[model samples]
Each structure stands twice: as structure tokens, then as C-alpha cells.
Target: MKTYHIRFYENRWIYYCISLAVVLVGLICNVIFGTRLDIQFTGGAVLSYSYSGEIETQKVERAVESSLGRDASVSVNKNVRSAESGQVSNNVTISLAGTNSITPADQTAVLKALNKAYPNEKFESLKMDSVNPSMGQSFFLKCIVAVLIAFLLLNLYIAARFRKIGGMAAGFFAIFALLHDVAMVYFTFIIFRMPLDDNFIAVVLTILGYSLNDTIVIYDRIRENRRLMGPKTPYRVLVNTSINQTFTRSINTAICTFLAIATVFVVGSVYQLNSVV
Candidate 1:
């Protein structure tokens, strides 16, 4: 195997510049678009309707908007079932979001609009549900508390495990990197207007866990190299060497993860699975 030396410390400024640029762009996007909270976070209503025929998502969106006199987030799902006679039937479900409880009158108005749009298709109201804002607020607070506790525990674990080689600094930097990742995810949500729901919490937690694992591996290597190289070894040399030794492992891991995610994304797109995509 061919071995090549990499001077990460010498080129640290370049990495810093790239990271800073990305963070700045994300912040700008957040400022421009603002945060979008979903019904799960801000308390709202979800109206689900099932239809027996093909329906254009755009038309359904228009119908809901006209009836409610406001724009809403809309999603459609299709299900296929076979009867005992071997005949196949398609069921389309349309979900609409609202900021308040959907009253009987409101449901009637929406149904009237949908009926007008699709006179031949039979529409059945599957369910209409509303979430209280207070409950959403409580859930949001619990999520925040959970994340904070996780971070604290991770920092303490890292500090105790790697105390020989600037453990405090290592833990702080690892936490900082995780926070940056979380901020980037939040920025993406703002830019895309993705609802801040339980899914958002899951994504943040997953990213934090993945990043912390990688950071701990690198820190472990640095601590081991420091012990082998003795106190005479320069800090810069130790860090760069440790990073270079693990660089291949990190790259391979990232590539494999990317491929897995890409496959799922492609399948979701092909099948028109909005939630998966």
C-alpha cells in the first residue's frame, strides 16, 4: 500500500473558511425564509379524505384552498387493493393541514368543493383530527430537554474517556461540530418549509449520534498516538498523524452511508412516497 502524508494543521485555515461559508449561507436562508412549524408542533387539524378514482393533487389543493380561504400543506397517497373477484381498486387519500379545528361547516364546505371538482368520484371522509397548541408546546419542550441531556451525557463521557489528551477541548469541539450540524438541518427545514414535527426531532438526534460516534473514534486515536509518541511529540504532528491514519475509515463509512440513503431516496421518488422522499 502507498502511504501519503497529509498536513491537516497546515491547511486548517482552508477548512475553516469552507465551514464558515456554509454556516453563513445557512443562516442567511433561515433569515429569509423563517421557521415553519407543522401541526404537530403548533397544534392544528388534519383532514383526510379517501376517493375511489384518480385525482390530481393540484386540483385537491385548489379545492381545499378555495373552501378554507387559505393556503395549506397538502399530500396525497394511493393504495391498491384486490377484491375476491380479482378486480383491483385504487384508493386515493388527500390530507390537508389547518391551523385550527375543522368544524362541521368547514368540512361541509370542503366536501362541497371536492364534489364539484370530481363529480364522478365517490369521496369518503376518513377522519378529521385536531391537536391542541398546549400539548404541542409540551412536546416541543420535552424534545429540547432530551437533546440537552444527551449532549451533556456525551460531553461527560468523552471527557472521562479521553482525559489524557486535552479531553475538555476534545469534548467541546465535538459538541460544537454537532451543534453546527443541527443548525444546518434547521436551516434546511426553514429553506424547504418543512414542518417542525417529530420527524425533525428524529433527524437531529440521528445526526448528533452519527457525528459524535465519528468524533469519538478520532479522539480515541489521538489519545493512543499521544501515549505512544511520548510527551516530546508536537501537538500538531500528533493530531495530523492521527487524523490521517483514520481518514480512509471515515471516508469509506461516509460513502457507504450515502449510498444507502440514495437508494432509499430513489425508491421513494419512484413510488411517490412523500414521507419517505
Candidate 2:
């Protein structure tokens, strides 16, 4: 495609600026309201149990809350059980704020509460998992250090490779693109109210890798154009030209990779693969 064909408007920088502004807003929200932590990040007990009988979701929640003597979260695992005709099946996942030892008395209380709600229902306790904030903090600190190191290396590499276009600006702009994708992923998770966990970190890393690859390809072509087509070309024109030249290759690559990841995501979600999500 020609440069004009690919061009959306006279100013491409506007798109970049808009993306930066959006990310800045998300960062501000993250700073103010804070991240929605998962059970692992906060002191909590995750109870996975199965229930069989006619029961409503609200009744299950009420039972868990009454048993805990505090507000606890309850989620249904529809993937675990098949709702055959006339049969009500569900796997209840209860998350309590405190990560104390689950005593036999606690289990009995919960069972009794659930029994009160649905006389014919039965509660089968399966497993429990717990984590503390200190552990989460330690993991978060490591991730921060790793991201910083990666960004530093990216800066040095881009600066060395693209001496023109003010290496500092190009490198920073590449980082800006990376921050854009990361912020978008976080915003998506927040909008969905999904638990913020290690999967989010993985998504951020994937975005960084993708953005870095795109920036390097565009910068490489720009450098080549400057050498062959002459540096007299305007900066905007040069960027647009390089982008048009590499558009097909870059798009094909991203599409193929995205298809593979999308497949994994779909299958993972369908099969309830927590590791992939």
C-alpha cells in the first residue's frame, strides 16, 4: 500500500499522543484506586467444594457469609459439573479474607449453614489454598526489577541501532508503545473485574516483546531509507514511507502470532486451564 493509502490523517503523531494519554490515565487510576488483588496477593483462604441439590447462587453466598461471620466471596465453577436434566450441579469456590487454619468446627459450621439453606443439599470439602501479602510483595518486587532491566536493555539496543531520529526519543517512544499495550491489558482486566495475578505480568511481558519487535522493524527501515533515499526527506514522510514498505510483513507476522495465542486462550478458557489464563 502507498503511504497515503495507509495514512489515516495528516498527523500520525496524534495517534501516538492519544495512546500515551490513555495509558497515563490508566496509570493514574492504578495509582489512586490501586490494583484489584487476587486471593494470593491478599491474606485469604480459597475453599473448593462441590454441592449437589437444588440451590441458588445467592443462597450459597449467604451460607458462606454466615459461616465465616464476615463478607466472603463465592464463585461458581460451571466447568466442573454437568447439569444433567432436572439435576442441579455446581462447584462452589469460596474465598475468605483471613488465611487461618480451617478448623473442623469451621467446616461443620459452613456445612450446617449450607444445609439450613438447602435441606437436601450436601457439601463435600475438597481442598484449600492460602497465601500472604508478604509473598505477593516479594513476587511483585522481582517482576518490577525484571521489567526495569528489560527496559534498560531495550533502550541501549535501540540507541545503538538507530543513531538517527534522536536515539533517545525513538527508544522512549518504543517504550511508550509497550506501556500502551500493557495499560490496555490492565484496563481490560479491571473492566472485567478479573483477578490480577501472574497472568497479567505475562501479558505485560508479551506486549513488551511485541512492541519492541515493531519498533525495531520500523526503525530499521527508516535507517535504510535515510541511507539510500537520502536524509533530505522530512521525518514524517520518512516514517510513513517506511511503515508502508513494511506494513505487509509486520501485519502478517502479528496476525499469525495472534492467531496462535488466540487459539491457546480459547482452548484454555474452554477447558478451564488456569495456567494459560
Candidate 3:
């Protein structure tokens, strides 16, 4: 067997520069486009209706805006059950901002407009929900607090566990990496116009946990290698060797996890499952 040595830490500055560039770009994009917060976070009313005919999303949006005297976001999804069964349904969801509670009159007005536009098609209201602005604000605060607590506990754990091998520095570096990942996610959301909602929070938390676990595994390998190589081993060699040893395992794990998630995302999208997608 032939062994090849890779100098990862030797060019560490390149990686740092690349990460910095990505983060800076993301920051600039967020500043220019602003964040897109969903009804769950921004406090708004969502009205969902199921119809059996083809409906233009623009027409529905225009109808809603004309009725409410304000612009609203509208989305339409088509679901086909089976070709043989010939079962098809279109779901229309309209999101309106600025009000916590939706009044019956508002709902009636929207329905009237929709009927006027699509006289032949029957629209059945599936659900109408609203969130108070104050309640949404409270939820946002709670999510922030939870994330902070998790980070603090993770730092403490890493510092305590790797104390013999510069655990505090390792912990701080891990946190920095996690933050970078979070920033990237935020940037992606802004770039793609994804809603900042409960799903966004879930994704951030999941990434933090996943990245921390990977870091801990690498850190454990480094500690073990240091013990084997003795204190005379150079820090760079020790770190690089540890990473090289675990690189294959890490790649395989990531690929498998990503494939699993991708499968779910694809299936959800195909089925028009908004919550899953």
C-alpha cells in the first residue's frame, strides 16, 4: 500500500480567505435584498383553499389585492394523485401581512372576489390561520435564547473534554465554524428568497448539531494521535494527520445523510407537501 501525505494545514490561510469571501458576499446580499420572513415569524394571516380547476396565480393575487386594498403573496400548487384515477386538485395559499387576526368580513370579501374572477370554478376554503405580531416576536426571542444556550453548553463541553489539548481554543474555533455555517444558510435563504420561519430555525439548529459532532470527532482523533505521537510531534503535523485519517469517514457520512435528505425533499416537492419541502 502506498501512502500520500496532504498538507492541509500548510495552506490554511487559503481556506480562511475563501470562507471570509463567502461570508462577506452573503452579508452584502442580505443588506441589499433584506430578509424574507414568513407569516409564522412576521405575524400574518394565511388562507388556503382547494379548487378542482385550473386557476392563474396572478389572477388570484390580483383578486385578493383588489378585495383587501393591499398586496398579498399568493402561491398555487397542483397535486395529481394518479393518472388512471384522474384525480387532480389545486391548492391556493394567500398570505397577507400587518394583521394578527383575520376577520370574517375579510374572508368573505376575499371569497367574493375569487368567485367573481372564477365564476365557473368552486373554491373551498381549507383553512385560515393567523399569528399575533407580539406572539411571533416572542417566538423569535425564544428561538434565539435556545440557540445561545445550546452554543454555550457545547462550548463548555468541548472545553472540558479537550482540556489537555488546548480544548478552549478548539471550542472557540468550532463555534466560529458553526457560526460561519449559519451565516451561509442565512445568506442562501436571502438569495433564494426563502422565508425565515420555524423551518429556518430548525435547519440552523440541525446544522449546528451536525457540524459540532463532526468537529468533536476530528478533535478526538487529534487528541488520540497526539498521545501516540508524543509531545514532540509538531502541531500542524498532528492536526493534519488526524484530519486525513478521518476524512474518508466524514465524506461518506455526509454523502449518505445528504442523499437521504435530498430524497425527502424531492418527494415532498413532487407531492406538493409544503411543510415537508
Candidate 4:
């Protein structure tokens, strides 16, 4: 196939401006509207209740709001299965997010109030995730540290392995691209008002692995060209040539992987969120 190539750095200023705009918009959204956090990061209680009969989710929300005197998030987790049918049964799970009181009695009171409202429904306190505000801040800081450490270690490994090529500078550019992907995902969630829960972290890590794999493939081609074509070939041409040669493979791999993830994500969203999660 004839290859199409686009220079990434020839108009470096354009990418820089686009990157800046993305980051700024993401920051503004995060600061103003903020991400919808799940029960994990901000310590809260998740109440999973299954009603024998179908119930309107809004009704449950209203009940929880009136009783607790605060709005609580309510969602359905339809994963419960019927023993007889060997299939998923009709079940509605309610998740209430709030900062639990420090004392055991206070926590019990919250649970008791929920039980009092719906005596017939099955109730399960799957887990309690509560961290003090100070602790939560520390945890956020640690997450950032972990990502930085991973980047540094991976960069070092790549630099050492490809020292015959451009060495650390090439590795650094690849790492920079990985960072771009991470930042893009972060900003996407912020602008879309999507929740940045534990899943977001998993997505970021997955992207890092993906982006690095592609970078290595391209770098290997670049190294091969440098050896066979000689140093007289400008690095820019070599880079562009390498990108064109391997672009199909990279794109095919990425497309297949994305399709698989999309299938799983769709299924999870439609039917198996609780069990899958």
C-alpha cells in the first residue's frame, strides 16, 4: 500500500498550542465543575439493595433524599441472577455516596435509616470506604507519584535498550507522547463530566502500555533504517519513512485492541457492571 505521512514536529508550534488549549480547558473544567468521583476515592458508603418487585429509581432517590435530607446518588446494578432460570434476575442496586461520620453509631444510624425506609428489600453493605480529608489528599498525591515513577523507569529501560539509536532523547519523546495520551484521557473525562474513579487509573495504565508498544515498534524500524540506509539520510526523513512503513501495523493493532475493549465496555455498561466491576 502507498503510505501517507504527516510531519508531527515540522509545525511543532501547532501541536504545542493544541496541547496547551487541551490542558487549560481540562483544568478549568476540573476546577469549576469537577469530575464526578465514585465511592472509592472519596470515602463513602455504597448501599446495594435488591427489591423483589420493580421500583422506580427516582422514587428511591426521592426517598433517600427526604430521609437523609441530602441528595444521594441512586443507580441500578442488574447483575443478580435467578437460581431457577440460570439467568440474570431483575434486581436494582442503589448506591448512596456520602462521608460517613467518624463514630460507629453515626454510621449505623445511616444504615438503619436506609433499612427503615425499605424493610422488604435485601440490603448488603458490601464495603465501607472512608478516608479522612487529609488522607484523601495524600492518596491523590501518591497516585501522581506512582505515575511519574512508572514513566521514569520505563524511559530508562527504553533508553538503555535503544542506545544505538538516539538514546535517551528518542526515549524521552516517546515518553512525552505517552504523557500526551494520559493527559488527553484526563481532559476528556473532565470535559465530558465523566467520573474519574479507579477505572480511570486502569485506563491510563493501559494506554501507557499501548503507547510504549507502538513507540518501540517505530523506534526499531528507525534503528534498522539508520543501519542499512546509513547516517547520510536525514533523521527527519528516516523518522517519517519509518512511521509510514509501520503505520499500518500500528493502526491495525490499535484498532483491534480498541474494538475488543469497546465490546467489553458495551457489554459491561448494558448488563454486567456489578459482576464485572
Model number with the top lDDT:
3
Per-candidate local distance difference test: 0.77, 0.75, 0.83, 0.72
Question: What TM-score goes with each of the models?
Answer: 0.81, 0.76, 0.81, 0.72
Q: What digit string (tens of lDDT, one per residue) describes model 3 on residues 130-235? A: 7677876787899789878888887899899998788788788888888888987888787787778778888888888788888889899999998999989999
TM-score of 4: 0.72
What are the RMSDs of all candidates, in order?
3.5, 4.8, 4.2, 5.0
**Residue ranges of candidate 2 with Cα displaced over 4 Å:** 1-4, 13-34, 53-90, 97-106, 112-121, 269-277
User: What ranges in model 4 sit over 4 Å off?
Assistant: 11-14, 52-71, 82-89, 102-149, 266-273
Residue 114 lDDT, candidate 4, scale 0-100 = 54
Query: What TM-score, to 2 decimals, does candidate 3 have?
Result: 0.81
Q: How many residue pairs clash in each candidate at the backbone level?
A: 0, 0, 0, 0
Candidate 1: where are CA atoms >4 Å away? 1-7, 80-99, 116-122, 133-136, 262-277
Model 4 lDDT, residue 138, Cα? 70
Q: Model 3 clash pairs? A: none
Question: What's the distance in Å from true for residue 173, model 1?
Answer: 2.0
Cα TM-score of candidate 1: 0.81
165-191 in candidate 1: lDDT tens per residue? Answer: 767776788888889889878877766
